[model samples]
Target: MARTALALREAESAAGRLRSELAAGDEAATRSAGSRLAEQADVARRHSDGWGFAALTHLPVVGDDVDAVRRVARSVDVLGADALPPALGVLETVRGGGLRSEDGGIRLDTLASVSGPVTEAHDASTRADRAVAGVRSDRLVGPLSGPVADLQQQVQELDRSLGAAEKAVELLPAMLGAGDRREYLLVVQNNAEIRSTGGLPGSLSVLRAEDGRVELGKQGNASLFGLSADPVARLTPDEVDLYGRNVALDLRDTNLIPDFPRAASLMARFAEQRGQQVDGVVSVDPVTLAEVLRATGPVEAGGVRLDADNAPRLLLNEPYQRLRSNEEQDAYFQEVSRGILDALLSGQGDQLELVRVLSQAAQQRRFLVWSDSDDEQRRIEDTPIAAALPRDEGISPSVGLYLNDSTRAKIQYYLRYDADIRSLGCTAAGRQQVVAEMELRSDVPDDVARLTEFVTGDGTYARKGDDAMNLRLYAPTEGRLQALTVDGEPAGIKVGQDGDRQVSVLPLTLRPGESVRVRALFETRPGQIGDPSLQWTPSMEWGPTRATARNLCG
Candidate 1:
């Protein structure tokens, strides 16, 4: 027992020296001591596994076996307790020298943080060594090898204690270390609308804003979007710590795997190693409050891909087609769909894809836009009616149209159709309603003047019992239509099919106030009649042609 106590004292003295060397920055000397300690610890562990501490109970005394065992047990415990102070002291000295920043910046470095875990692991290993040594010393000079059965019993007890200490030592390194060192990713989501209401939470501007800078100054101001917390600017350092304790008060704290100072150092080191500038921040969003958060990564590691344009495609698997609503479409591409499409079309041998959407201001008016690409330029071109019409194996038009003389800009090729109007989805008021349909296009420089001449001048024809057309515009008055008239005639008349509702119809051939029977003319059998003409009457309108259905009998 005396020899065992002297050996433990020597080990404690060596441990104290190693701790002092580490504190003095003599890592080489400390490492040498640590290596020797590891070797001794391994030997002690082996001895403990082989023989139980009860072996210590049986000192090398030729006395009653039970009495010797009790006496040895008490002495061995006293020696172990004395060894603990030095082991624990060494651990404290190394671990107390926490991270230090050479750069004098808030950002942390991994090297500094790494030193702590290394020190802790080394300390744990040293303690584990002392524990093993105490057990072994008790066994070496003790009367443990009494009976074969008694030796086995002592060996079992020593094995359990050694296993626990070894496990603790092994786990110490892992627990001391920090998590992944990288910049935190933040995600902000909002509605795409006429105006952006919400802004990013952790951006540099918001964090640096002074008091009252983010306030909504006026009553009924809809700009701020009802979110009003500035966690970054408002939280004090102590408050930040309280929040981070378990709740992770700051978003930045949650991003870090280790403590704050260590985490900061690690992030800075990671940035340096990767050849980039890295900043750390946390984010909060009231909009997506309930979703399980996923990491947003600026770094492209571990099969993570996130970008605004590309990210949406991951969720929507279908091929990208332009959406139909004009307001919605404009908001998405910032009203640059046309310019983008034009750029795509200017390339060599690239096909242009047109996405058709409805014009919001006018119902049934369609417009075509294209997606942006770096390829070709696309321009809207107008072709003659004869060539633009679908080809038939029959007689074609005789005259060739030239681009220089055509009214291309006046006639939009893509005419939008609204199902709601055409389908008459709304309930009708009576059995009798106006129903008229015509197909008319204009090439005149002034559509209103051309329409007026036909409607109120000597050009219109009307037939008795062949229902007349009526005019109705959604506008409050017909002042604009009247302004386009020459000599007292109104231009641009609106037309209805039959007379239960008022619609305007144009005249095919007639003087003012003339009455005649009306029939739509068609060249069914070409070159068959006089001047190749059939009985024709005119509508009162020269506006864009529309198909209308109405009930005439009242």
Candidate 2:
């Protein structure tokens, strides 16, 4: 009862602190502080409640047990105010004697406690059922509050109770019918026997690293086995008498490693699925299964399908090896397979339609340039194989190019591989080829600005491993402008700048192995008085020298 009261107080204090912290500023400090405080508060409350219940088993009177349970239940009601009201009301209906009894025999109430080993285990089972029931109702309301919270609260209670009950049940059988029996107690201790260690023991065991101590029957054996005295000794009844408990080795602490329970559960599940008998493990009680179905939902058999009624149990007496039960498997299957099936199927269907539309847009943007090396400058210039293809609406695509000089020796160009598709149907592999080697250019007027944009790969650019592109800018007025600036951030290239005009070169040297993207931004004042228009032409100079129209949009 004291533990229960302490848990209630701690929970209340935590709630108050949480409310206050939430009302404070939403800064990182406040958020982290609030989270830590909430976690501490919850830990305190849970420990208080869990240890309080454990202490309740020591109660001498029946009235004390009832009072303690009621106190804990009331605290739960307070903590779970958003959910406990409706569940409490339901429990109250069956609280009275004979209210739920169908016949003269003993009948289980929705919420009732029973004494003794089996009865305590049953109590745990009942609480678990109550939790599942609360979760179901919480789902119906589309809110995981009130009843949902209550269910979660009940689960914690059941978890502790079940653990305690299982321990008591396992240990009780060993102690039962032992009428002052005293056998030869041999206490052989060695450091080598230690296998897996965790929790505080893992840390504290470091202190014992000195000389690897071994003791036998309270005697240190330094020369027993001839191999540095492998410790072995016989413990007399008188020497073991120091242990206050009637049991053997009461001084030794029990290892609370989590792997033991998990391994046991898995082994039990395997045995059940394989139709083998397993002893001293928690078997899936058929009665518990019925209660689970009543509180939760339909059950599934095998890995196939679910049935609303006639649920199957993955018992320790089955044909196949199972890691989890039918109920657990079913729950996990629903949880993991929620949206994945639709995503894969829909993505496959959209791939075909995207390829056709992009091909048509490629043809229109294809152009030829005049080469300076040959005497006839109008001679056929270099063009990609994809660009020279005949115009076929179902098979061709257009390509557009824009360039800006970013450095003294190089330039960057923005290439658009524009394709009109209603959806993203092209697979990543299918869209890879066309996106590479597409020309990109800037819309800005100033050469320096366009160069800056290209160097930074700003505005818009394709993220592809494609063939190289070349960039060049013509700036006759201003010799070589200062470095480019993209959105006011400096790029590396240095160029010359004058009023309303700027130019910067770029490193648009695309080798066979290198992949590159170019961006450019232009910033200039309006044209001078009587000037027809202020023009800045950023050109791409690689296989083809095509100048892009700049400042036209402005």
TM-score per candidate, chains pooled = 0.18, 0.18
RMSD of 1: 38.4
| Candidate 2 TM-score over all chains jointly | 0.18
Show the lowest summed lDDT stretch of 10 residues, model 1: 353-362
- In candidate 1, stretches whose alpha carbon ends up further than 4 angstroms from where it belongs are 35-54, 58-554
| Candidate 2, 281-302: lDDT as tens digits | 2111121222233323443344
Best by lDDT: 2
Residue 282 miss distance in model 2 (angstroms): 20
- In the order shown, the candidates' Cα RMSDs to the true structure are 38.4, 36.5
Regions of model 2 farther than 4 Å from truth:
1-121, 124-147, 159-163, 166-170, 180-554
The residue-by-residue lDDT of candidate 1 on 1-554, one tens digit each, is: 33333333334444455444543435456566545444433343333333453464355543234333333333333323333333344334334432212221111243343444444443533443433322322223342422212222222322322232233233322222234222221212111100011111111111111111111111111111212233222333432332233212232222112112222232233323434333331222211111111111111211333232343222111111234342432243221221222221221111110100101100110111111111210111111100111111222101100011011111111111111111111124221111112222322233233222212222233321111222122110110111222122444533332112111233222222233321111111121111110001111111111122111111
The TM-score measured for candidate 1 stands at: 0.18
lDDT of 2 at 108: 29
Scored against the true structure, residue 250 in model 1 reaches a CA lDDT of: 30
